[model samples]
Target chain A: MTRITSMKPVGERAIRIGFEERISEETNRYIAALCKAIEEQVHPAVTEWVPAYASLTVYYKPETSGFDEMKSFLESCVKDVHDLEGEGGRVIGIPVLYGGEGGPDLSELASHHGMDEEEVIRLHSEGDYLVYMLGFNPGFPYLGGLSDKLHTPRRDNPRQNVPAGSVGIAGEQTGIYPLASPGGWQLIGRTPARLFDPEQPDAFLLRAGDRLRFRPVDEKEYDDLCSRVENGEQIVEVEEGEHAH
Target chain B: MSFTVEKPGLLTTVQDRGRQGYQQFGLSPAGAMDEYALQMANVLVGNERNEAVLEVTMMGPVLKAEKDMVIAFAGGNLQPAIDDEEVATWKSYHVRGGSKISFGRPVNGARLYLSVRGGIEIPEVMGSRSTYLKAGLGGFEGRELRKGDRIEVGEGAGSSEVHAGRRVASEHIPSYEKEITVRAVPGPQEDYFEKEALEQFFSEVFEVSHQSDRMGYRLQGEEPLKHKNGADILSDATAFGSVQVPGDGQPIILMADRQTTGGYTKIATVIGVDLWKVAQLPPGGKIRFKKTDVHEAQRLWQEQEDILVQVASYGRS
Candidate 1:
């Protein structure tokens, strides 16, 4: 059973339950599982549940449930949740165009790591990143399992606008920019796939607990994929992963 | 049943209580910043409390009523006038077809809520009409009110007799003050900050910085509060009214359009009942935090809910 280190009121309407202070796939899985269990055990007062790296915040209607009532409900629910298993989600394949104007910091990142640009691309594409959570921006996934060799700190001066689909790394984590926003990550490549689209039937291109793999594509392929996306085509491939944990 | 936007003001959008049940997927619950006022405005117009209303920020929009309608203005005194004739706020007004309703200088507060007899008839996205500007979803075309944008209203009772001259009591309506005191409960991460910093945070009067927006209010004043260890904390879910202190030590109070999660340490969370006070504070407004326990916060919320429930009885008897 996962030990819940603390449970406290975050404002009058919400209660934050912290499982651990550290971030790990196991702890994140527990967070996700606990989130699932809480949703399954629906309390009318609980309006929303937001799961993060190692904690889950439960937003409730204060008029319906007070702080103590919600806290007790969460405590009992957490006690019932035992497994840290994550239900294996879809594995999404992302096609990337690496080392060009799309990836402004690629050459700098390669040299900083004492590796060539090609090696950087190869290592980055091979690593299977697990989507821990989606936050920061709409549909922006916080992925784990980046190769430690490629770990680079965020830029001192963040770029004013990193284009959407710009794959970047910050500290030990890697993610893609879903929208054109100011960011401090070191850009390494650009993906042709649209990660966030309100117009799409599914809306968001990714979900938490999904596995993501990057495959390198040339300039022509990138343009073709972009056009396909604009034409409202689902070019990105999704396959079944191994099994639910 | 409809109105044409003659001149869209600073930032006007449709909002209800909020977008709920989708925060887990990283969706911020974009809604009316001053929900109490939104509810009161709806109550005055005989619409549901969660009905979508026009949320005017900073400035006011110039709209031409396409049809005779009963509308109520609440929250923020924008000095609303019809055809240049001044109209008192917190009361229902009847506007004839082709009559122009314009808001002059903002005499008080930062946001104004306008509710017609019926709610704004916009397509609901994810169970809400509230606009989340960052994602371009919900509200009218998922954006702010602009010139020539025509909005349709629902069939609100279809009564020819307008409930004009109906007003909420002066005590019921919150007066927007240049200086406000917001009550807060110690946060889930209150232990993350040093004791001295916590004392300094409560004692100091903070000014709302110009950088403040719907997302958050960045306060500026006093020395930056120091964390017990460092500012960096494990990324966690954030709530509206969460007061997060970043590396610079300034507290940023998260609001209706805040991101789902953040990594900064949140020392405290403003109570939900008092968030309207925070929402109405214009830029350069002064604020001081008074620490309160969760029970007291819950009591305040219950009290507000009771008053709203009582207001729902208007026009019924």
Candidate 2:
């Protein structure tokens, strides 16, 4: 049985439901199942639900439901969430142009790992990464699968401006910069995929429970895909994957 | 039904209640920092609570009304005036076409709201008029109001009644102060910190850092709260009022424009009712925290909402 350690109030209108201290697939699936049940049951006052590595934070409208009422409602809802089998997140492929302008730190990262840049790209592209959460910045995915050999510390002095679509690695995790902003990640490559677009029916390219893989592309191919994405073309491919838990 | 910006203020932007149902997509609910003030200003001028209004920060914009409009100012006092004639805040005013409205330096608080009846007629993006400055997504052209910008007002936004002389009851208004006691509910991660750090957090008086903005209020105070397992936590979903303490140990109260999730441990979350109070606090203002449970926090919020409802009812009368 998946254990839910506690359900505490984040404030007046938001509730944080905790599972355990560490990040694991079981916790992620439990959160997903819980989120599924809540959405199915539909708490009228709940305005938003955020699923993360270990917990799900629910934001609600105070005027519609007070803390006591909501606490009980969530307690009841959790009791009915019996199925531990979490839904399989869709697998999406992100095409990247590795090395050179798009990947300024690729050589540095490869040298640090005592491997060639091509080998580094091969390791990164072959792994199946899980989308633990979307955070830090809009549409930024916190992915969970990184080859230990390619582990690199973040830049001591963060970049004033990291270009949008740049793929970077920090510690054991890898992610893509959804927007051009200040960051400390070690840039390895760039993805032409539009991670965030308000105009799309689905504003964000990725969600909390999704599987992603990187496919290496040449600079010419990157330019072609970039134009296609900019022109509102869905160039990336998404397919079904195995259930999380 | 329209106005022209003669002089754009430091950070004037259109805001409303906020954009809902989008936080899951890594979008923050960017809206009026001081919802209480925005709501009151909207109600006084016969506009809906969600109607878009101008949020003025520190300095205020110089606007020239192109048509007769019923408007109200709320929140921090920027010493608003029409053609050099002072106009009292918290009350609706009937201004004639060609009236020039300007504001002096802030007399109190950090943010002020200017609402015209019928609301700012800006197209909604993701179901909100509030500006998400980081994404450049919504509000007046996805950014702050600039000089020479023309803002259109919604037709029939104003009620026939002038609403002049109408003011929120004195007790209903929140007086901006340099020192404030903000109530908070202990954390989603309160246990992550050491017992000594928790004591230090509750006992210390922290001053808002100079870098504090709509995104979050960074605090500068005593030794940063030390976590038993270091400050690093699995990046988790953060609420609007989340008081995230980073590696530096400074506390940052995530606000309307905060990120959807954070990696730091949140020691506490300011109650929703008190968020507006924190919003009004200027950078360098002092804040002390008092622990309260969720039940008490909700009761206080409901009480405040009831008062606002009673005040809004006065507009109808």
Candidate 3:
């Protein structure tokens, strides 16, 4: 019962919606139970929703709601998202460091998959991924499982500077670049964990149904957690969703 | 009271009427690219209609005043002036105190705003004092407005009284055309184009491309669009007048500091009351797209928010 196939109108103050077009986790658990049933009844001219990789968008406020009153307030924030369960997300962790100079394509993507650079950093620091959307910059993310024997494609000559937290991968996806622009993925590692920080009070260190893992670390614990995340220290930990109240 | 710079033009910064709900963490709601000329230049300088202003861009800054203040300028018409006289945008003045105020060529639009009377004292970050200059974050220091900077102000209607000129109603100003059309609302994809490339994207025209900025605007038509089996998608969200279309089919648009998710194939959007004619177009101008649907684009976006509440009741009397 997590259907949503169409909803359209991404303007005159946003809509999108769509689901069931691909990228599993059962369509990101019905886009995280319709973003937790529209963040539990939000909709006073909505104003923010986003999710992605199977769609959600939302955003409202056309002088306080229009478009059939926000399409029946998002069709009454949909209800049977497979009997909505959600209380899961909040893993976090992060660390990294992988190869030299921010993983210069980690020994050529571990010899293009013959596996070596420490078995491509133990299959990209093994599992627990799933981010499915943040964006092409500012806090980046768009991650999805990967590990199809460490798939790798996007680099037909790309990087014109890839720095800011690196990580990469491309084809069967895997991300992390949160802002040093110009990319084409495949890098392999580098993550001091600031992941977008407009002087943080939670300025994004990952969010679209967050849950990430990764660990590794070694350039002296990535230069001591990059000087304690450049001294506004939050040094990556997260965990918290105990029934995410 | 303040203002100093001395010609830092071709891209001044600080904006407002943006930073809304954090674009779901990928943060790119970087404010005012002409939000009805930033609420009519912050209600003709009586400030606080989302205050902060100064946009400029396409050569304009020259500042000076540093104390007497109380200005206003509004969008698209970089020909403002003072030390040499000629000043006329949506009006509201009162300068003095070693004045100067300047600006000059490009008499049309490509952003202008300005406003003043006690506002740009900069601080708000996530709650926005606008300016996301590709993530340096908030205004005045999140970058731009350089060469001897200075600025400051925000105290309370620029130390009480004296800014009385008001103008606005030239039929509430909004004509900066070099051939514009805008309207858009087409789709969350428009079935990924190619119905004659979505009828040549509403009968072609395009243009505007000096590699544009404030996050987008790279159009340039000589007929490219085609898609239907390529132009990739999966990446989503992207709004401020989206349009996208990549895979070299050329379309871009997405402004007001873009990037809140995207992977191409947008096909249409521009319709927050015609996004100030695509934020006052201008590189090579031209543009086109007409379409209109989200129930008449939210009733012309709530009739352009009741024409900004009748332009704030004509700046109060």
Candidate 4:
């Protein structure tokens, strides 16, 4: 995606800057790059900076600085960051136990797509999904790059409560529930990894721009992983790439 | 120092200034509905500004003092009585151990704030004591005060000499009535509506519909002007007092328990200075809107802040 060419006033105190490209894969890359660049430069007066799937919201203290100054400052920083290509994204592998009690809706979901449960699982795990954004709930990743064959509409009526760590698909996107919440996604499997825990220093386990690969595991393995997690074993492997600028 | 809940009233929850800096995470700043009153109550008893206070809605509970404590109460027109005689509110008072404090029906306003010296002691969740009822997180066990709940009251190192008969000026006291006037600023999504709808919004008198709570207040008024793109918009961040008109045309004022984001278009936002007035309005209160610019709104907010600072300083003295 090209650099942000212009910044427009959103309100009395904030401005919205858009890149040349509409929200796309390249736009997501720009979002991550701009967030890191702005954090390194012009840190003060900024109360909060929230980066969404396609946009970044920068909230500043209006009393301290005017809108014009913040706009110019952000514009300069984005121009500089555009010259440097952003760090390559990290890939995370998540193990899941599909079908049976672990995934009650697997049979039903397969039938809805006119395929067997094994083919559904095979298609789902074969492709790598990109983390578009973290939203809806804490640590819940909105994943993109789903295979067209496994694409399915959400349940007509959402379940009152979907257990945490349940992997599901909705329309063109797929995600894992970080916590028990009402959801309309079609569940295909359950993961043993914990996506969110308030007690941990870094409560959120996933972030935007991270890639994920789902590896299938058995019921015995799921039970064993849970036990290991309870015993303070780290189930998910996270790698910090050298390219992060 | 502590207090025991003898009869937990209609709805009682511990609240502070609010949970700020987390709206991006889909969390509302679930603070006291009447923040001005909460602050005044805390300042009256020498507690910090964000100290936890009991936000009692409509009627209040009967609280029995477990120990001798100094306390202050503000907001609403509830008759707080010790045994039989009525006691004045908005001033600090000393209560002996085992004294019983109960409340009568609210004569005016909808919420009352009770703050004790040093503030109520509770575990902070997500850096706040305010209760977000829908999420079932923060505040006393992530729920409202129930019978048999014992709440601890903070005790500062220094104790001051007792004084009596201090009260807020009669003119300054908020008058809760059947109608309230709200100052507002056009929102980012205001242009989505027709020009005539904007005109009707300011000129018309809207009644507070029955479906109202901490989450939102649905209004009964003239239908909102439709847009060319219809009511479908991407879900985005929303704040308190956001006047959002859904497909039905009725405007819903997003409140403390409102979701972090919404897809409906917002017509306007109630100015910060007038939010307290909106909070005090009863379910059936009539409301009229007056449009103002963001500059004027900011100026009014500064004026309110100045007044609050003066009041807080006077209490300290």
Top TM-score prediction, candidate number: 2
lDDT of 1 by residue, B170-272 (tens): 8898989989999889888889888999998888999999999889999997799998789998788898899999989999999999999899999999998
lDDT of 4 at B7: 93
* Runs of candidate 1 exceeding 4 Å displacement: A83-86, A241-245, B157-159, B315-317
Provide all candidates' interface root-mean-square deviations: 1.2, 1.1, 9.1, 3.7
Error of 2 at B209 (Å): 1.6
Work out the TM-score per prediction.
0.96, 0.97, 0.37, 0.87
Consecutive 10-residue window with the lowest summed lDDT within model 3 chain A: A79-88
Candidate 4 steric clashes? 0
TM-score of chain A of 1: 0.92
User: How does candidate 1 score on lDDT?
Assistant: 0.88
Q: Candidate 3 or 4, higher TM-score? A: 4
What would the per-residue lDDT of candidate 2 be over residues B1-317, giving only the tens digit for each residue? 79999999899999998898877768888999999999999988877777899999999999999988888999999999988898878888888889999999889988889999888998999999999999897999999999999999998644454675578778877888999999899998899899988888888999998999989999998787888887888878888789999888889999999998888899999988888889999988999998899889988888988987877777767
Ranking by TM-score: 2, 1, 4, 3
lDDT tens per residue, model 3, B211-242: 88888889889978989799987787888888
In model 3, the number of clashes is 2
lDDT of 2: 0.88
Q: Model 2, stretches more than 4 Å misplaced?
A: A84-86, A241-245, B158-161
lDDT of 1 by residue, A61-117 (tens): 998988888888987887767744435667999999997999999999999999999
Every candidate's chain B TM-score: 0.98, 0.98, 0.37, 0.95
Which stretches of model 4 miss by more than 4 angstroms? A1-22, A41-45, A60-84, A229-234, B161-166, B170-172
Best by DockQ: 2
Which lDDT values do the candidates have, in the order given?
Answer: 0.88, 0.88, 0.81, 0.75
Clashing pairs in 2: B118-B157
* TM-score (0 to 1) for chain B of model 2: 0.98
